[model samples]
Target: MLAALWAAEGPLGAAAVQSALGGRLARTTVTTILTRLHDKGAVSRSRVGRGFAYSPLQDSAGLTARRMRNELDKQHDRGTALARFVSQLTREDEELLRNLLGGAGDGVRGGPQPGVGDGPRP
Candidate 1:
């Protein structure tokens, strides 16, 4: 459902989304899923007639990153969790991360960020 919305050029009504899915899911089911996504902050909705038009708030990669951050936030030992996660990353991913971090080294680009309460995390 989210993929369907993400693929849309603009916000879509439930009926449109259902049609996009080839009607495999009922309109109510699509509406329900969109509602759930809206509640989860994964999508945004606008009043459309008596119903609403929905659009994905983030692309797939961004959604995955948000989920990862949420999961990390839930951990009691975030440092340990992040360490383990980085430790398990494939070489390519590890290198990519290092490059990203390196690029962010300068404050203007998204350098090392201040901790919570101090400022935003890059």
Candidate 2:
């Protein structure tokens, strides 16, 4: 049900979601899921005539990033949190992270890279 909502290009009605789910889910079930997602800040809804059209607050990539940040914030130790994250990462992800952290072949050496700023706010 959530998959169908996520796959939709824009806000969708319950009927549209049911159709996308190939009638596997009841409209009431989809409504419940949408309500839950809305409470989680993952989805949003707007009035459309007498009913409503539901849509994601963020795209998949943005939602993933938000969830990752939320999970990291729940960890007691920042280092342990990061370590656990790195441990789960694939080789390509590890390499990319290393490069971003000033590993070999990374162009930025002493300070923040261009367009990436660090300092007190104005």
Candidate 3:
């Protein structure tokens, strides 16, 4: 459902979403699902005639990152979990992360440093 909405050029009515899904789901089902998504903050809706048109609040990548943070928040041993996560990364991914944490190609010579204000802000 979200994929249908994401692929849309703009907000989509439930009927449009249902049609985009090849009519596999009923319009009522699409409306119900869009309502649920709006309640979950995953989508936003605006009045469209008697019904509503929905748009995804986050893109696919943003949604994935949100899910990752949610999963990490559930872990009691977050440090250990994060360490394990980093340990399992491929060399390319590890280097990419290192570059993201530091500056590009700076390498990991220095340990954790104080905030340089380059990371995402609340």
Candidate 4:
């Protein structure tokens, strides 16, 4: 899985990854997951002998956000879907989202951001 690739010091072959993960997953399953990750642009792969070696293209949070966007793309009403998703956020999360969106252009300053370090805005 992605976690396996993330933990690897460098690109890893599917067999090595499967073995490292306690061999709970078949090598073929690991290959399939790696292929999927490659297709998702979360990882890059290259031929290594008869098999492929894979390496992560992004950090965990970037990979997770890409997955979230892919899931969002499948919804019929994206606005409703996003609204419902946002509605479920805790106050702290909401504040974080608001600040992140608001600070899109201006680089984050030295001051503590809302809901960060200082807790949610009252």
Which candidate leads in TM-score? Answer: 1
lDDT of 1 by residue, 3-69 (tens): 8998899999999999999999989989999999999999999998999999999888789889999
Clashes of each: 1, 0, 0, 0
lDDT of the structure predicted as candidate 2:
0.76
Residue pairs that clash (backbone atoms under 3 angstroms), model 4: none
lDDT, candidate 1, at 28: 90
TM-score per candidate, chains pooled: 0.85, 0.73, 0.79, 0.78
Quantify all predictions' global Cα lDDT against the true fold.
0.84, 0.76, 0.83, 0.83
Q: Put down candidate 3 lDDT per residue, 11-102, tens digits, no spaces.
A: 99999999999999888888899999999889999998999999999988788877888999999999999999888776656665675776
For candidate 4, the lDDT comes to 0.83
Off by over 4 Å in 1: 107-122
lDDT of 2 by residue, 21-108 (tens): 8988888988788878888989889999887899888767688788888988988898988988888776655555566776546555
Error of 4 at 73 (Å): 2.3
After TM-score superposition, what is the CA distance of residue 26 in candidate 1 from its true location, in Å?
1.1
Query: What TM-score does prediction 4 earn?
Result: 0.78
Instruction: Spell out the clash pairs found in candidate 3.
Output: none
Candidate 2 deviant stretches above 4 angstroms: 100-122
Lowest lDDT 10-mer window, candidate 1?
A: 110-119
